[model samples]
Target: MRGPVSEGDWRGVVRDVRVTGHRVTKRATHGRDKLLREVAWLKALPPKAVGYFPRVLEVRTGEGWAEYDMDFCPWPDMSRVLVDGTLTVDEAISGTRSLLGFAFDVLYADHHRPAPEDFFHVSYVDKFWRRASAGRGMSERFDRLCSAEQLDIHGRVYPSAASLMRELQRDTVLLARLRPPCLGRFHGDFKYDNVLFEPATGRFLLLDPRGSTVTGDSDSDYMEDLAKLRTCTRGLYDLVRAGAARVSEGEGRISWEWASWAGPALQRFSALDAWLVDELSVKARARRDADWRVRLDVLMPLLLLANAPFQLAPVNPRTEDIALVLHATGVRLLAEALELHGTRDLGVSP
Candidate 1:
């Protein structure tokens, strides 16, 4: 049982109760009957569809509040397992894929709504560039936080925010197009922490659906979104690789500089990446095409480069090392994109 769940100013509680040989959870809230009603609606889904979620048993409306009963599961949330270092990379990926697949399935099956555009279009690559471009002042905010020990990792020093932003922007670009074709539904918040993996059976159970959104639209838009998402996924993979590298090189303790910047940056990046995956999964299940997939393959590296900096704390270093990595990665991604799509004049756009 959880809550007092709050919606704006209203708050309430969820209690666990057993009724008629079935375990159920109940929610009580004040001045927000709609939320309770939504929960009830969520609970009332058919057992098979609702089984992935909690089943709604009953709903009660009162003078100033509403309450509903729902089925309950006893397993621990995947987030707990992750923080404890109990999950393997393969397990994380499998669990993430399954949860996303289930989210897509449920949204279409239950609500008849299509996926949302921002879900697919946004990427860590985009975020990375945005933050990096903010320059020294922005990076300094995170830097000060680090110097105070408010942030810590294995001990590696962080790159300055300005450096990271420059690196990101030098690597990527964003293109806008119409939405993609509908393939299926999506579980809107797919991530490592939200998926439960049973170690014994290697089975995954998805938890959390509060952020799910569905929108049925055109194929072009969908493809564009998917491309961005794939890019985000690749970025996340690179981050994991970078983190692991730091861990291995530091002999179990990450540098304080690296830890401060990377820790918060990675956490935020992962969340954005998970959201992108959920968006892409929904599009992929509904429509299939080889070209879109190929484009994504090309874009992934570019996006990865763009978003790499926001995930680290700034470290004071020689100009050459910073400039070299940034320019190299940027040029590589840009060259690859041009090779695939043809060279366009590089100048500031009006």
Candidate 2:
């Protein structure tokens, strides 16, 4: 009997069946037709190359949903592995790289463009940055939630709704202008939750491609995006620097005690810094294809300032790091804005 299976975003019903004397499971989601389409697409691809995806058995359109049967291999997701502390960093990275590489190869090589009807395939990175920068509606929603309860920030009251709204709007504009290149196909929602890993064999299984999409944007927009990403990423690096400085100041310079406690904290900070730099550099290559300098000078700092608050929330040695980075980056961005648009003090109202 088929019953509801509570997974992530997709709605599905799973049932038990015997296939060739082997007891297997069948999962169906008629509400989501795209799953069937993607499954078909994957099946059409060379089996050896697309072995990561589930082996399809049958796809039949029924009353309410499409019935999809595959060889049900019960595997644990990355989150489970993380909770159990079983997955090594190397294993995780390799697994992630495989999925990302596959997506990129398929889209770029095959020219598997996004269909006109497929809006759901829109990339998550694009969506996140766009929504983050386009602040009015979201800010209002955030404000309404804050007003219903007392919000606190670093022993201080949260900023007024209007202030939050203004900040969000400013951030949104800066991020939208940063136009990072969409290289072929993207996983859309590339996060730990959607990935499964077998720690023993170092195998990673990527499930649910509901968010995958084809890249469709101009070269200029893509370049601008990369430039903006660099600025935002650099801002993150600067924040780490500021956090380290604060930690040093708070706990005197060069002490064994400080070194022991702060070592792990420092490693995390370095990890964040390294990730940002590598990501920025990887994305920056696309910028070489267009007029990046002009757009970079204009958008980089703004993107940095806009993203500061969100990046600085976690209470690590780098707690104050985001604020410091924002201040420094904001200075450059504000100066440029003034230079271009003239000194117009849009001071905080209310």
Best by TM-score: 2
Q: Candidate 2: which pairs clash? A: 30-65, 30-66, 133-172, 134-172, 178-224, 178-225, 179-225, 180-225
Q: What is the C-alpha lDDT of each candidate?
A: 0.40, 0.40
lDDT of 1 at 122: 38
Candidate 2 lDDT over 1-350, as tens digits, reads 11232122221223223444432334454334455545655565554456665566776666654555666556677644432335554554455455445543442343333323222123323333443343223333232322322222222233333333344345544434333333333333333455666766756665554323223221123323333334423333332432333321111111112224334444433453355445434544533424234344544554444444443333233544434434334434444443443323444222
Predict model 2's lDDT versus the native. Answer: 0.40
TM-scores for all predictions? 0.42, 0.46
Per-residue alpha-carbon lDDT of candidate 1 for residues 55-150, written as tens digits (9 for 90 to 100): 556677666656556555555555555433455445545655565455445544433334345433333334444434442243443333322321
> Every model's Cα RMSD, please?
11.7, 11.7
